[model samples]
Target: MSTQNYLVISALGKDRPGIVDALSKSILEFGCNITDSRMTVLGGEFAILLMVEGNWNTLTKMEESIAGLEQQLSLTIIAKRTEQRDRSNPFLPYVVEVVSLDHPGIVHQLASFFSKRSINIEDMATTSYAAPHTGTMMFSVHMTVGIPADIHIASLRDEFMEFCDAINLDAIIEPAQR
Candidate 1:
């Protein structure tokens, strides 16, 4: 017997206790096996991104099995085949981490900077914690981005420094190894 291929499934909604139970039940009903997954609660919302393997033709059935889950949990579900091309090595991989006092427009500024350079942000996570008595908020963000091999890292670093100075935020960029 050969191993079955896999598809990726992503779901997100308000944070709740039963989201995983509901999701697992649906996956089991379609005879799909979840090989790897990452689930996290961000700002009161639960997000799950999973990699599942099953019969190639079972994609549609798997989707249907989870359709009602959206209504039951009031969540959004997205399922798609994990394309082989997307699994290949990247041309250039890099990481950018930012930490600073909580403020608006940070994401917008950083995202726009990367977008202008044709960089692709593959994954990103951000969180903020407020100090109980100090009334100061701390913000932190981590992102894995892919850039073309032709782009210059030095130039990117310089631009990021300028951005950091303007926003009074500290930023760091470094090459990410595969």
Candidate 2:
């Protein structure tokens, strides 16, 4: 007889070289296969999200191995089985992009707006880069937000436009289908 397996692990910590090496070593120690993974540095923080698979009986051992790594690297780790469902289902998946002069509170304002409306943000990637010629900072946020089928997209667009106007930034919201 064979045991079933399922799990996803994600980690985030201060950005530094060798973090990936440490994480890979830990994963190897646990003997878990990396099914799929993505890692990136955002605003001086290194973040990793990975899907791992192994026998159910070894799940705790795998988690323990990663927990050791977390302590060694001062990382925050989150692990959950694949069967666990995420709360909040915002209808259809859509992408919202905003590019504007970098300033404080941009993410807060946009996220606040969505939260107020019960929108589920699946994934968001935001970065600040220098503007060409001007050398000033510009912020770019690409968010995958969930929109309910019954929700009026036009109204959302209108509200986004108004919000963009108030913040002096350009916001674009569109349905994201793969």
Candidate 3:
């Protein structure tokens, strides 16, 4: 029987080309399969988070070589052993969209609202830009959320709308098409 090892890898460094190429080469050479990953530019830094799967021996080898990779790439790297996660989730998926004048605390407020209801925010991306004609600073948020099975969808949607209205944000909450 073959045993599998899961690893959570994160790296951050000054933004530059070849970051991904270097990391991918190391992972491939180490015989780890990239399962899921998110890479983005945050300010002047390039950040990467990935889930990799390999046999126990391969994973150990990767772990041992991570320090050298970090030094070579001038990155801050962190890796941790992770167990297989349960794929079954009872929560229903929903997409949330919000747009309004740019300001602080928007994400915090949304997180507070969801935490109060025991809802899980799975993935979210937010950006700020100037409105084409108005030249006003505008913020947009798109998020995937998981509503608990015990929650009432209609009531939750209504409450969310009310909260957004109070905050002067145009918002929409709808079932996500998977």
Candidate 4:
């Protein structure tokens, strides 16, 4: 059996129409399948994170063409080889949500909470906006974390709630539906 070759690529440039089209077309031409991707406009910049998989030769050919692609698309591209994540000590996925008045260090504090417990944050996103009616600046965080199966759910929930309370954040921790 042939092993799969995986490449993770990040492209950032000024936001524009057809960036995805151009990049994806190149991947298709090189015979690679885009396994995962996250594309978003951050301020004036368009950022992309993609994982593509193919056979060794096809991936190499694609890598060789990245420089030209960058020039054509006006993107700064970075690519690296990676393997599938190891899940030997698998985690039970949990979703965490937090909302509070906008302030500094919220993300950092939340990360510290999980890091201290050796929890893995698999995905996270945050946004700030004006609160409806009140017009107060509000911040919200959504994160997916990996909890070790050995950890007791009830105790973790209680601790997380209390921690949020101390920080004046309204939050919830629940098992991820998916």
Candidate 5:
């Protein structure tokens, strides 16, 4: 069997219709599979992260096309070859959610809390908006973390709650529903 090669591609450009179509069409033409992708519009810009899988030659061909694609799509494109991920540690996936008045440092504080415990944050997203009726600017965060197998869940939960309380942020940490 031929070994499959993977490439991680990130593209950013002004928001427009048909960007996804054009990108996906190019990948298909190169005989690559879009194994995973995240596409979003932030303000007036479109950003995308795609993980593509193909045989070595096809991936190389795709890489060679990036410069032209950038011109064609008016996007800044970056591609890097990567190996498939293998989890080295047995860890539980937990989802963390937080809500509070929008302010600086909430994300930083949350990151510090997890980093200090050696937990891995797999994914996260944050948003700010006006609260219903109150017209208050509110910030919310959703994160997925990998908790080491050896850590006691109850103790960690207690400590996390205490940390949130001290910071005056409402939060919850729970095992992810697979």
Candidate 6:
């Protein structure tokens, strides 16, 4: 029977134009398929996370070749075998948006609230900027969270709104469009 191996690979290095090209070259040469990937520039560094799949021997070849690529590109590369995960879940999706005066404990507070409820954050992005006209520092957070299907959305929304009001944040929690 034919078998496939899954790998989760991560790389970080100084931002440069050819980092992706160099990694893609090695991945191609090793005959592995990049199933999913996320690459971003954070500060002065380019970071990459990739999910790859291939036959056992092809993956072995990649493991051997990555060392050379790491040295040539001056990157920190890590690869680990991972089991294919079931992405389907029984949770309902919600989009949460928050805007408030910049403060240190905003993220921590939100995370604690969600953690207490057993909610799962699927993706989150946050940023800070000066508010228009006023020039006041503002923090904005946008996140997709999975709420357990058993929870009543109306009650949960009421509680969430109360929490936001207590914290002086302008927030909205709404159903996410698929």
lDDT winner: 5
Candidate 1 lDDT score at position 152: 80
lDDT of 5: 0.96
Q: What's the distance in Å from true for residue 131, model 6?
A: 2.2
Q: What TM-score do all the candidates reach, one by one?
A: 0.77, 0.77, 0.94, 0.96, 0.97, 0.87
For each predicted model, how many residue pairs clash, with residues at least 3 apart or on different chains?
Answer: 0, 1, 0, 0, 0, 0
Tens digit of per-residue lDDT, candidate 6, span 1-178? 4398888899999998999998887887789999999898888999999999999899988887778878998999999988686566699989999999999999889988888999988778889999999999999999999999989999999999999999999999999999
lDDT of 1 by residue, 112-156 (tens): 989998898878888898867996998988999888778888887
Q: Report the candidate with higher TM-score, 3 versus 6.
A: 3
lDDT of 5 by residue, 1-178 (tens): 5399999999999999999999999999999999999999999999999999999999999999999999998999999999888788799999999999999999999999999999999999899999999999999999999999999999999999999999999999999999
Worst ten in a row by lDDT for model 5: 82-91
Model 2 is weakest, by summed lDDT over 10 consecutive residues, at 83-92
Predict model 4's lDDT versus the native.
Answer: 0.94
Which 10 residues in a row give candidate 1 its minimum summed lDDT?
A: 82-91
What lDDT tens digits, residue by residue, belong to model 3 across residues 1-178?
A: 4388899999999999999999998999999999989999989999999999999999999999888999999999999999887657699999999999999999999999999999999889999999999999999999999998899999999999999999999999999998
Model 4 clashing-pair count: 0
- Comparing 2 and 3 on lDDT, the stronger one: 3
Q: Which ten residues in a row have the lowest lDDT in candidate 6?
A: 81-90
Error of 5 at 137 (Å): 0.4
- For all candidates in order, the CA lDDT equals 0.83, 0.84, 0.94, 0.94, 0.96, 0.91
Candidate scoring better on TM-score of 3 and 4:
4
In Å, residue 18's CA in model 3 sits off its true spot by 1.7
**Which candidate wins on TM-score?**
5
lDDT of 3: 0.94
Candidate 4 weakest lDDT stretch, 10 residues: 81-90
